[model samples]
Target: MSIYLTAILKSKKDKIQDLKSILDNMVLNTKKEEACEKYELQQSLDDEAVFIFHEIWKSKEGLDAHNQQPYIQEFVEKVPDLLEKPAEIYLAKLV
Candidate 1:
């Protein structure tokens, strides 16, 4: 079965631009993955510091491989300095 993921990240008051750059890079690389059906990024109009990712993966194994990519690992390392809090992630079904 396909997997859908929604991830919301909030940047520190001063780190929105930096966070956006990283996320943009992620989009570029993620789009190259064979198993990524969708990997769209969005910013909230009401809260500029909030970033969201709407992603769909072909399988759990594909998503796991994605998490291990070097760029993604770098994001994990750098996020502590850029984010206001841990990311909010959800796995949901289309129903």
Candidate 2:
């Protein structure tokens, strides 16, 4: 079964561009994964500091593998200093 994930990330003051650059790189790399069904990044029109990700993975194991990726780890390491708060993530399945 596929897994759906949505993540919301908020940037710290003056860090929108920096965070966006990182997110853009994430999208670039993540989309290349064989198990990635979808990986979309969107910026908020109302708030420049807010960014959102919509993703679908082929399986939970695939997502688990994605979490272990070096690029993902790098992004996580940068989160504390660049973000306003920890990322808010939601998981869903089709009813």
Candidate 3:
């Protein structure tokens, strides 16, 4: 089964741009990773304060590798300070 994740982030008014910037960088870098099947950042059309990340990895190990990547760690650390609420990350297995 493929590994998938949906992450929701609600950015503070002042950090919306910063959140986008960071996510943009992470998306670009993620595409280069061996385990990344798909990595996308989406802005909420109805709510400008919301950002969504859709990610697909090759396997559980691949997802783990992605989590351990330095930039991923950095991105995770940066999100809390940039958001109005804590970011929510969901992990799923393709059926």
Candidate 4:
């Protein structure tokens, strides 16, 4: 079955633009993966520093592979300094 993921990221007050640029690169690179079904980046209207990633993959394996990608790893390594808090991630399936 397809796997769905939602990740919420909150950038530090001064790092929002930098975080957005990094995330934009991640989105571009991630969408090229063969197992990726959908990938989207959303910024909150009420909070400029809050961003969300909505993703769909072919299967759990696919998502796992995605997690291991270099771009993803780079994002993980870089986010701590840029974020206000730890990212929140949810894994789910379509109802």
Candidate 5:
């Protein structure tokens, strides 16, 4: 089954640019990832605190591999300090 993830992030005011850069890198890397089907980021129109992310992978292994990627590893290290709270992630399977 395909792997799906929806993440909600709250950006800190001082880290807005850093978060944007991270998202940009993620977008580029995910497009190049072999098993990626879709990976996208969307900003909330009404709430400056909100960032919405969607990810799709060919399989659970693909998702796991994506998590282990270098940039993603770096992001994991950097993200906690850049956000108002920990990112809220939900895993899903297609109906």
Candidate 6:
């Protein structure tokens, strides 16, 4: 079955622009993966520092492979310093 993910990220007040740039690059790179069905990056209008990623994968295994990608790893490693808090991730299935 396909897997869906919603990830919420909050950038440090001063680092919002930088985080946005990084996320843009991530989206560009991740969309090239074979099993990526959908990937979107959205920024909150109410709170510019808050961003969300909505992703759909062919399967859980595809999502797992995405996590291991170098761009994803780089994002993980760089986010701590730029983010206000840890990312909030939700995994879901169709009803």
lDDT of 4 at 8: 97
Which residue pairs show collisions in model 5?
none
Per-residue CA lDDT of model 1 for 42-64, tens digit only, reads 99999999999999999988999
lDDT of 6 by residue, 1-95 (tens): 99999999999999999999999999999999999999999999999999999999999899999999998999989999999999999999999
- In the order shown, what is each candidate's alpha-carbon RMSD? 0.7, 0.6, 1.1, 0.7, 0.9, 0.6
Question: Top lDDT: which candidate number?
Answer: 1
Q: What residue runs in model 3 are displaced by over 4 Å at the alpha carbon?
A: none
Candidate 2 per-residue C-alpha lDDT over 1-95 given as tens digits, one digit per residue, 9 for 90 to 100: 99999999999979988988889989999999989999999989999899999999999999999999988999989888999999999999888
lDDT of 6: 0.96
In model 5, which regions exceed 4 Å deviation? Answer: none
**lDDT per prediction?**
0.96, 0.93, 0.88, 0.95, 0.90, 0.96
Write the residue-wise lDDT of candidate 5 on 17-36 in tens digits: 88989988989888899999
* TM-score of decoy 5: 0.94
TM-score of 3: 0.92
What's the lDDT for residue 8 in model 5?
A: 95
lDDT of 5 at 10: 93
Alpha carbon deviation, residue 52, candidate 1 (Å): 0.6
Which pairs of residues collide in candidate 1? none
lDDT at residue 82 of model 5 (Cα atoms): 93
**Model 1 poorest ten-residue lDDT run:** 86-95
**TM-scores for candidates 1 onward, in order:** 0.97, 0.97, 0.92, 0.96, 0.94, 0.97
In every candidate, how many clashes are there? 0, 0, 0, 0, 0, 0
